[model samples]
Target: MTSLVTDTRVVFSRELRPVLRDPFTVIFSMIQPLFFLGLFAPLLPDSPDGGSPLQWFVPGIIVMSCLFGSSMTGSNLLYEMQTGSHERMLVTPLRRPALLIGRALKEIVPMIAQAALIVAVCIPFGFELHLAGALLGLVILAGFCIGLGALSYTLALASKNKEWMFWTVQQTLLFPLLLLAGVLLPIENGPGWLQALSRINPMTYVVDAERALFNGEVLARGTLEGLVAAVLVGLLGLAAGVRAMRRSD
Candidate 1:
């Protein structure tokens, strides 16, 4: 068990080095969320209670950051594959599952950091967050990112050398999930079919939970539901990613 943990750490360190060096990548990832905060957030009508629209919008932006950042993790794996580095690493002493776990875990660091940045930026815009609830929300977001990152890596493995297909599949998967989660607007106010679809989307639960958490509703049903959905996604993604890695071996 110790060895597995150690190996995973080593792999994670290796994967994270490049990200640390390329600070611009992290900045670029935040642009979309910041854009929403800057442009779209002002258009939202003030609540009857006089709360800023930022209170409602920030949670969705955090989740959107997770969605976009985590989903693009595969691009790194795809690069390694094209350069033959992934195959080279497979021949090393590292356990097969550790490789995927390491890469997936690395995604969580940038995700949480970006989330923190988003929260910090929103504070001036009147976004309110409870300390304890923010901590729990971060945990939920981490789980979701780990799972999504694993799935992204798994998709990369499946796509192999086909760069075009990998991107196509990623776009096909990301936009619908984003739209269905209603990050840009409330699905409840949309068409009936859209509302129905949002009900089934796990991301919707995540976003709802985040909003509740931001409002300090720590014990809300949405919080529990979102945590469960995020855990399930993590487990499923880890399983699939591990299986895919082992197959590559």
Candidate 2:
């Protein structure tokens, strides 16, 4: 058991080092979301019934960071696959599941850092909230991102396609969730059907919860729901990825 944990940590450290080394990725990951928040959040129509676009969009921008992280999940594995490193690793006595889990876990660092920067940028724009809740929101969003990234990695491995599919699917699936999460528009203000759909979207729960946190609205319910959804997504993604790897072996 200790060995498994150690292996997971080793793999996580190996994956995290590259992120730290890549100054460009770090710069863009942390700054781009803030840039979006400043430029696009204001252009959104003023909301009388709902909160400002900054309020609505901040959570989605945070989620957007996660979505982008998901695109890279497969890239590393694909590169290793092409270079024969992945095949060699498969022959080791180390637990393969730990390797995958560790890789996914390490990605949360940058993902959360990116989200934190977005939250920090939001403060100047009048987006305020309890520090405790904001911290909780960041943790929750990071978990969701980690899970989603794992799922995307599994998909990439399964698809065995080019790099474009990773970006394409990440954008296609995650962007719409952000849109529905009341990012550009108020989920409550939408049509009944659309509101219902948003309610079903896991991303919506995170947005709703964060919005409440920002406005000092109680958001225990949304937070719980979002947490559950993120956990499920992560578990399913990890399971699939492990299964695919097993098949390859």
Task: Identify the candidate with maximal lDDT.
Answer: 1
Candidate lDDT (C-alpha), each: 0.88, 0.70
lDDT computed for candidate 2 = 0.70
Candidate 1 yields a Cα-based lDDT of: 0.88
Model 2 off-target regions past 4 Å? 29-32, 45-53, 161-164, 215-219
Score candidate 1 by TM-score against the native: 0.95
Q: What is the C-alpha lDDT profile of model 1 across 1-249, one tens digit per residue? A: 458889899999998998799856886777877888889889999977898888788888999999988888898899999899998999988999899999999988888788889988878767876889988998998889999999999999998968888889888988799889988888878989989998888899999998888778999999999999899889999999999999983
Tens-digit lDDT string for candidate 2 (140-200): 7666776776776686676564667666776688567767777666667778999888878
Ten-residue segment with the worst summed lDDT in candidate 2?
23-32
Q: Give candidate 1 regions above 4 Å deviation.
A: none
TM-score of each: 0.95, 0.85
